[model samples]
Target: MRQYLPVKKFEWPWSRRDNGQNEFSPLIPKSGAAKVEDEELGHVDNEYQTGTPSNQDHNSPTRIQPHYSYSLMDYFLKYFLFLCNLVFTVLGLVVLGLGIWGLSSKESFAQEKIGTIGTDPMLILLTLGFLLTLLCLTGCVGALRENCCLLKMFSVIVLVLITIQVLFAIVAYTVQDQIEGYLRSGMLAAMVGYQDDLDLRFITDEIQLGLQCCGADTYRDWEVNLYYNCSAPGVLACGVPATCCVDPLENGTVWNSQCGVGAQLMDEFTAQSVIFLGGCLGGISRWIKQHEGLIGTVGVVVVGVQILAVFITTRLLENIHRHKAHA
Candidate 1:
């Protein structure tokens, strides 16, 4: 009867056994292997939640979130580039407009003259203006949006343009004799078309008046023109343009268009009194030499600006890369 009475088992909250003595037995203690296994399971759970290996947790700290650091220089450069490009964009449009106006004013787009448009000076302005507008627009948008592709394109174009300018400078300095010859030929051609082409005539007149020189080499060079040749039937034959005259105004009141009439037939000494005897080539050379310092300064500034832009673009690209890597 005494052996038949049942004893209630003491159960531990974590124990699942119907006979609960296995959880905290006085006679048979819990195995050290079981305690170690339980601790390992808890560590694996923590690692899963944190997305890290348990062993590496001690070796490395948790990753910190990434943040963009916008420096003062970054802000300055961003807006500075945008503003510079905006101004140049406007300037390019103005140049394009002026080129179109010049071409239209001279009727250079007429069907008969269309074939010659490629060689027109206005075409050069138009092409240059279009390129400048496109290039500056890229830079402006790229800076604002922080677009890598656009910035890269802008940088590459700028680099190419800078290289071209440098090469042009080098060629101009190295081929002085050839360049002078080319210039002489170009001036003569312009003079030949002076009466027929208003653009050429205006350019010729302005050069003559501004440089205080006549033709390309001398006042006699006007004979190259059909209308100004001595054998021509026109009244302008053997005469130079009024721009060649030292004082084109009569009595400092009215413009004297006939001041240079028959001046090409005059002797050098006599012509010197009526019109300039010196060539525009010498005048141009003198002007360049006189302004060489200013010219060099401007060239350096332009090159420096391009170089700075390259540097800024590189910095922005690196910053973008860093951000992406962290992300």
Candidate 2:
């Protein structure tokens, strides 16, 4: 009498007791031990079981995620960057060595004038070469080793330099009128050492010869030099450098060291026959005006190269991150 008839088989739409628990939508969907709704929530859950069951769970260590495959282009770009930086590094080293040699050969460290070394224009070349070498070396090693730190550092420095250059350009443009005054001051300072500083003398000579002009403003500006002043007792009194002469060589053979002697004391017509009548400032301004387009183009190219480098570095860094994540 107590025996029950065959239990009526009924299937619930959202319930199943086959696994001893109600199923739920898999949050991470691929699995054997799927996470279900909390038991204490008093809610029914659902899950779609497939024909083939997965042995892995949501927390399984062996999860299948997409892996990044580096293409040939990536490697090529990496090595190309490395090679470029390496080449620049070598060139920087050469320039730096040459600067050192120039200074050393000139005995720039001699006790008598060592204190004036800071004013030497060769320091500009040395600084540029050293900075180039440091930045390139960092970039080269960073590319070769896939080092994010070095790459970031190199990119930051380059970006900073580019920013500085842009700001300087803006400032220079804004102060264009005063630039001539600044140049005059700098020229005067350099001329003060024309006889004592070999670097200054060479630079001054080159400028005069190339521009076919004399002092900062006029040939008579040589009076600023004590040795060249009219009141000086020296034979070279009131004379300009040989570089300012109409022809710096005698008979196109011997060096005419005294060609400019007493040339500054002559009238304009007389001086015109012996030396250049124009001043250097006006020539420099004209030269700059003529080359403004070229200067702008070169600046653009340099900045473009740096921006491209930054972009390339960012991509490489991203790839590195992806590969590390995959690992």
Candidate 3:
């Protein structure tokens, strides 16, 4: 959309070379200035269009556009786009492989489970990885091959993803008040399955250790687990998880697995000395509040990169069209 400064026309190698004057000379203003190839290229700053007037049909050629040549910056941007997508393609493949591994290890695709694999949690990762790989691979091949179709597909998909992310972000921000309640419910559900689900157990332990917090809302919240309930007839009854302990290691080395025993039976004052009394919800909230700036910066950077890729692809497609039109 940028208008280039009008300058004296420069002739191509096969141009008439008739002192920059030809059949179209009357149509062009007599800007009797000497040709400056470098300045003309610099001013265009993108596709360099050159008149391709044929010796047979001068009047007819005047209605057509000139042949287009790409500038150095255009080539650089195209290659840069290729490299960026190449990197993401590799990452996408890795993620896809990991998702496949996760699903295989869990036998989610077994004969009996195959019917339900679509609803399996691991399928989420597999879908994400597949889409990422397809999108980035399209960009990579399109850039390298100068294929307008593939590039346009990549641009459309990227724009859709960006729009979805922005809309999701807006909705999340609008419903911020309900998010904490959802987190608490999910945390509680995870706790109830702590002993049965390895993934949930690992996540719960990580949250406890990382934040030095105990349950969803408090240490007593562990009672939601059947084995940890006060009325349960087991050693773990009325006990919190070892991860809730203030110091779960004995002699600063061995893990004191029973450090949180009977923690739920103790008074707040007593439990404070043994295990974490606060809950992960508070810790998670504080963590987010503290690092919101970094999170926002990351979000902005991601959206900006998508925008830049779309812009680069648009320019490449434009130049390709121009070249094809005048060929």
* Index of the highest-lDDT prediction: 3
lDDT of 1 by residue, 141-230 (tens): 998888989999999999998899999999999999999999999999998988887778888998999999998988888999999999
- For all candidates, the clash counts are 0, 3, 0
Error of 2 at 135 (Å): 0.8
Q: Rank order by TM-score, top first?
A: 1, 2, 3
- For candidate 3, write residues 236-269 as lDDT tens digits: 9999989999999999999998998899999999
lDDT of 2 by residue, 172-255 (tens): 999988998999998887777789878889999999999999999999988888888888899889999999998889889998
> Candidate 3, clashing residue pairs?
none
Q: What TM-score does prediction 2 earn?
A: 0.80
Off by over 4 Å in 1: 1-61
lDDT of 1: 0.87
Error of 3 at 21 (Å): 53
Off by over 4 Å in 3: 1-67, 110-121
Q: Which ten residues in a row have the lowest lDDT in candidate 1?
A: 17-26
